[model samples]
Each structure stands twice: as structure tokens, then as C-alpha cells.
Target: GAGVSQSPSNKVTEKGKDVELRCDPISGHTALYWYRQSLGQGLEFLIYFQGNSAPDKSGLPSDRFSAERTGGSVSTLTIQRTQQEDSAVYLCASSLALIGTSGRAGGELFFGEGSRLTVL
Candidate 1:
């Protein structure tokens, strides 16, 4: 019955450091997605997982960005070398598979308060 959860709510880091942010999706939801929203920017798709298959990393800005889903329930987005440009709100969403149109059955996504990353 739990919805998606992200940690830290806010992260401040120096440029060129590494950071890992966590996300927990709702139970029974088989599809998960990660997106980033920079200042005055729209949501940018980062990566997505569907079951045990390879993730879609097409949207990840650079090699420094990566993500993984564990036990098909939780996920973590990692930035290898934090940059000022990476500072933004990372959002996670989940949805049911049947006719899965990106959002969960109530697939609109119950977003976390967001881990606002500030790379100084």
C-alpha cells in the first residue's frame, strides 16, 4: 500500500563528487521510472526498469549518471561525478503493467518530496 519514497529530500554536494539517491516504489507495481528536473526545465527521462530486463538508459545525460532497481521494488540513481549542472530535483514514478501507459493504474505517480541536489 506504500507509494514511491525518496530520501534526503535535499542533497548539497561539491562539484565532482559522487552521490546516490534512493527510491522505493509501491508494492505490485512492475514498472518504474526516473526523471530529472533542472531549474526552470521540464522533466527529463533518465532511466526505466521493467522487471528483470536491461534498463533503458537512453535519457541519462552522460556516463556519470546511472540507476539500478533491486528486487523489482526499489531503485537508486547514482551520479559518478557530481556537477553543478546535475543539481536538480530527481523524481521517481511507478505504474501497473496492464495497458501501462507510463503512469501506474492510478499511474499519475505519487512523487516524493524530491531529493533536491545542489552541486556547489
Candidate 2:
């Protein structure tokens, strides 16, 4: 794919179940990001991966949420003991340049059609 790709676009799970979401970023992009959007929370950053290593994971809502990137290409987000409050649209994005630079012009991310998770 030319841009970021996410799997299981729609997931419906029972409360307390575990779920894993997958993301495959654009080739050669060193920066990958995971974000969550819900009614209450407009958008929140979950993690930022530079290559296969995550340097910022402070945005994770709780210990139950985790993510990892492998080979600097594919990434996975896992949720443990899922709660109803965890239901939201998970978005993935990638960019060729490093993010959060002081004066980088036109630094944009290619985002995937978010994976919608529903906890019932």
C-alpha cells in the first residue's frame, strides 16, 4: 500500500475480552503513530515509534493499552481486559520525516481509515 494500512476495520467484542489491532505503515517511513478518537476525547496520541523502537508512550490511557512496531514497518496495538470505555476509533499514521521538530515545514502524516472497536 502507498499509505498506512490497518486491519480489522471493524471489531465488536464483549466486555473484558482482549483485542489486537494491526497497522502497516508506508514503506521507508521512519515515524509511525497510534491515536485514539472517541466522543469524549477528540484525539489522543497513544504512542510514537521511531523505527522499531517506541520513544514516547506517555499518551497511553492505562497499563492495559500497549503497542509495538517491528522491522520499522508493521505495528500492533493490544488492549487487555477491554472495557466499554475503551471503545473508539483507532487511527494509525506514518511519515517519512521525524515528527515534532521545531521548524519542519510541511511535515504531514499519512493516516489510515481508523479501526472501529466496539465493546458490548
Q: Pick the candidate with the highest TM-score.
A: 2
TM-score (all chains, Cα) for each model: 0.87, 0.93
Whole-model lDDT, model 2:
0.90
Tens digits of per-residue lDDT, candidate 1, 16-67, equal: 9999999888788677778889999998878778864434678899999888
In angstroms, the error of model 1 at 97 is: 1.8
Please report the TM-score between candidate 2 and the true structure: 0.93
- RMSD to the native, candidate 1? 2.6
Report the C-alpha lDDT of model 2 over 1-120, residue by residue, as the tens digit: 687899989999999999999999999988888999987778788898989898778899999999988888999999999999999999998988766675543347888999999999
